[model samples]
Target: MAEPKNEEFLDDIEDAEAQAYAEEMEEIDDEALELDQLRAERDQLRDRFMRALADAENARKRSDRDRREAENYGGSKLSRDMLPVYDNMKRAIETITDEQKEANSALIEGIELTMRELLSVFKKHGIEIIAPEVGDRFDPQHHQAMFEAPVPGTKAGDIIQVAAEGFMLHDRLLRPAQVGVSSTPAS
Candidate 1:
């Protein structure tokens, strides 16, 4: 009877030990699952932050490009309006002949000085004249065809005459040179 009682007590101790070990294992498994969930949440947040940063950088670059363009081309409208004044000055100078200059030396000199000053101002503002000479190849980008004519010794698409000179503000054309293009082949 004593031996059986001792055996029963030992069996009860073993059962208690097994149950405690199983409960400990369940707690460990729950902790590991919670750790994995936290890692996934952290990765998602990091991805969102990276995307937002890229968007901000792109917006900044776009704004800088817009500002530069505005700075470079802001005076285009005013420059365009002043072109007719320059044209009139040039025409006045062209109409004066040697006889006229000799007859009115003082007046001619004053007109010449004023024209020079205007041209200097134009140069300072990055304004350039697009003057295509006769016999030169006609470029549509800088020249506008006012008329086409057949002329001897000129190939088709050659510049026959320039009716009015064009103006350019930097690389942008304020006005295209009005020209007559040759329609006949070279004789």
Candidate 2:
């Protein structure tokens, strides 16, 4: 009877030890799973942070480019509006006869001075005239052909006449020169 009782006690001790070991393994597995979840959360946060940083950088660059363009082209509209005034002034000067200039010398001088000042202002602001001479090669970029005519001693595409001069605002064409182009020489 004492031996049976001792055997039963030892079996009970063995069962208790096995149950404790199983519990420890379950705790370890739970800790490992929690660690994996934390690592995945950290990776997702890092990816979002990188994407947000890139978007902010791109927006900043775009704003800088827009500011530069606005500074350069802000006066385009006003400049375009003032071109007709320049044209009228030039026409007035051209139409004046020598007799008219002599009779109204003082008035003519004042007009000439005003024209010179206006031209000075235009030059300071990067406005320039595109005046092509007769016999020059016709350039489609600066000259607009109003008419084409066959002429003696002139090659095709030669500038035979300039009806109106062109103007440029910086590198851009404010107006194209109105011109007559020569066709093939008459047979």
Candidate 3:
């Protein structure tokens, strides 16, 4: 009977040890779950940081491009305004009477040379004249129609007259060419 009692006590001790081991394992599992949650959060933060850095870089690039464009086109308006002066000087030379020019050949030559030099300065600064020649096809991108006229032999949509010469600075249009375009003949 005593031996039977001892055996039962030993069985009880073995059951208690197994329960303790199971509880320890459960605690370890809980710790592992918490660690996994922390790692997931860290990964999300890292991903967000990288995305923000990329967005900032893109914004910086856009700002740089915009600044360069602004700087390049800054003088366009003033340059356009100055074009009329150049045109007036040219007209003064061209419209002078033949008698006046013949009487003052040296003075006329000096004025002509000055006009050429002024044009050279314009070219140096990337300013260009938009004087389309006669019989040239009218381009709406550069020409502004002031009137429509029918000529004896000229085709429709052709530039018959330039009211005011246009100009461009770099690739930007400073002014559209004021032009008289030919009209379609009356049927």
Candidate 4:
């Protein structure tokens, strides 16, 4: 009877140990699940932070582009309004005769000086003159055809004459050069 009772006592001890091991394994499994959840949350937060940072950088770039464009093209309207004054001054200087210059030398000198000053201001402000001469290849991008005429010794699309000079403000064309295009057939 003593031997049988000792065996039963050993069996109880084994059951208790097995139960303890199973509980410990369950606890480890729960901890591992919680760790996986934490890692997933951290990854999500990192992704969101990276996206917000990219959006901020894009907004900054757009603002810089807007500022640059405003600085370059803000005064375009005023610059265009002043073009006629330059044109008139240029025409007056070109049409002046030698006799007129001799009779009014001081006045002519003043006019010439004023025209030069205007041209200097235009140059300083990124305004450029587009003067197209005759017999050059006609480019529609820079020249506006005022009239088309066929003339001897000229190919089709050849420039027959220049009616008026053009102006450019920076990379933009303020006015196209008025020109006459030849309608002669390409031979």
lDDT of 4 by residue, 1-187 (tens): 9998999999989888999999999999999999999999999999999999999999999999999878777788988898889888888999999999999999999999999898898898888999988888898889999999888898888898988888888898988999999997545
For candidate 4, the 10 contiguous residues with the lowest summed lDDT are 67-76
Q: Model 4: residues >4 Å from true position, as ranges?
A: 1-23, 185-187
How does residue 138 of candidate 4 score in lDDT? 91
**Which residue pairs come into collision in candidate 1?**
none
What does candidate 3's lDDT look like per residue over 12-122, in tens digits?
A: 888888888899999999999999999999999999999999999999999999997777677787787788888899789879899989999999999999999988988
Q: What is the lDDT, from 0 to 100, of the residue 106 in candidate 3?
A: 95
TM-score of each: 0.76, 0.76, 0.77, 0.80
Instruction: lDDT winner between 2 and 3, please give it.
Output: 2
lDDT value for model 4: 0.90
Which regions of candidate 1 are displaced past 4 Å? 1-26, 97-114, 185-187
Evaluated against the true structure, the overall lDDT of model 1 is: 0.89
Off by over 4 Å in 3: 1-16, 97-118
Winner on TM-score (3 vs 4): 4
Cα lDDT for residue 72, candidate 1: 60
- What RMSD, rounded to one decimal, does every model reach? 3.4, 3.2, 3.3, 3.0
Instruction: Give the candidates in order of TM-score, highest first.
Output: 4, 3, 1, 2
Error of 4 at 111 (Å): 2.7
